[model samples]
Target: MAWTVPGLLAVVLVAALLTAMARGYALRRQLLDQPGERRSHAVATPRGGGIAIVVSQLLAYIGVGVLFPQAAATLAIFSAGLVMVAGIGWWDDHRPLPALPRLGVHVLAGLLLGALVWHWTGEASSAGFSVLLAIALINVWNFMDGIDGLAATQALLASVAYALLLPAPVAGLALILAAGVLGFLPFNFPKARIFMGDVGSGALGYLLAGLVALGLGTRSAPWTILLVPLAAFLVDAGLTLAGRVFRGERWMEAHTQHLYQRWVKSGCSHVMVTSGYALFGVAGIVLMHVFTWLPSPWSHLAALAWAAAAAGLWSVLLNKVHR
Candidate 1:
């Protein structure tokens, strides 16, 4: 189950091939995302290419579980939740579903994922929190997937960070997920050949939530570590939702109000915006790691300082975008 260089390379190659094939299939099936007022891209592009990432990561998990029988139950639970989310997303992708029904499916999948975390950590109270976190992450990730390559790039960076922070089995899963996203990136970055669709975005959010839970269950680090790398997405989405409610707008309706969206609207290319977010993610990872090496009080102070800095940066970025 140890991820050797050869194993990583193999996973990446397989995922890339699968993604390319999925792109072709998507084009043939006319699964395209069309240009719109809320959309960032101009031309129609094939979507649902994220299926490749989902399949690749799931297969890697199964392989790892088989090789290490002790981890099979946990892996099975994770896989089951992933399948549920991905299935619902795929269904939504092909045929539009009511918001309530899609939300319900997301809640169910979140509960399943929460239960998996509870089983691992033996903390029933944390399950509720985990469920809420999972649901929120799924929706937030979906909201941020408006631009080409942004979600995939963020997922890749977060996955790699998790792999570095977690222990063996969980780290192995994170590594595979990182590879899977990397495989999908070539088709998505700069110019899009295909989109990840709802299927990929929702499932990725679920996967990251699961990883965060696993990290909490196994590691002794401050819980803030879990939130650090995700601060960028959380802040942008959270603030936008709050602002919408304040303005009496339909917060749930699709719009180009997110910081990243605004940046794109400000004339930055998709690649430029995505790279900026990736850098933010890296800063978070570095800060989280540095905090771990500090004394308890110092670590708390550092976390607060980072939070303030992030808020200030967000404010500055928002000001740059003409509403």
Candidate 2:
């Protein structure tokens, strides 16, 4: 497949238009948006914008994969993983489902999609590592969803950035995903008109895990592509959970201890906070590849240690932010 700027642009445009239209419809319908304390923004914004993102990305992947059968199997697994996100996220959006039930869906979805992905691409060995990676990313995306447009914005930046970095199948699909979220950002940014809700955030999270896995395991571009840019989310989620455990608090329940959440609570602008995270994430990726020539082991222990330390430090650091 020839890499062309026009082709990528075309995919992005399609995604943006699709997401914008879906968000517009949600606005017109006055869907479920009950904003109050605990939310990033004060205004009531339309929700469920993730539905459009899921649809646009799925369609784009299918269209591309059909044209390039060699990539079809890999993409089919991606598309299936997305369906899991949509099915379960949409259900949660309509009515908050039990935590265990919702988690069961995520777990099953991750495992099933993981199996398909592993089988289709001979990623079986990678799957052993990817199962935990996939689940961690899904939670990272979910936990980072607290701020207005933060999760969606991160998805958009990471997708496009990584696409530019690795332009084959990963970049192609990422182009579409980025476009879809970019189209929705205007409505979801600092002063949001609509939110991505669980639909967009969850699906984006799942898709990201797939992209990173493909990029790292197959492309071997750099480990940083999968880690640093996402450090903000990973650190926050990992650290928050660690802190909770240390403090004898439940890890899964809703809370405002996330670094991003703490920043917002301290009277910082949401855009400023979100942008800070994005920059830090991009920095992490850059640093990863600065020495890309070095052969390295894919150390899960090291990754966890980094995440745990970062989270722990951030949890403590946040205490001094507004206090």
Report the number of the highest-TM-score candidate.
1
**Lowest summed lDDT over 10 consecutive residues: which window, candidate 2?**
291-300
lDDT of 2 at 235: 70
Candidate 1: C-alpha lDDT: 0.86
- lDDT of every predicted structure (CA atoms): 0.86, 0.70
Instruction: Write one digit per residue (lDDT tens) for candidate 1, span 115-138.
Output: 877887788867877898889988
TM-score attained by model 1: 0.96
Clashes of each: 0, 3
Candidate 2 per-residue lDDT, tens place, 1-323, comes to 55446555665566567667766777777665766666666667678877777877777777788778888877776677778867887777777787778677678767865675577458676665566666677667777787777898788777766676665655676676777676667767767766777777778888887777766555556454356556667777776788899999878777787788888888889889988877766755555455344455554444444556556667676877858
True lDDT of residue 86, candidate 2: 75
* TM-score of each model, in listed order: 0.96, 0.86
Model 1: CA > 4 A from native: 1-3
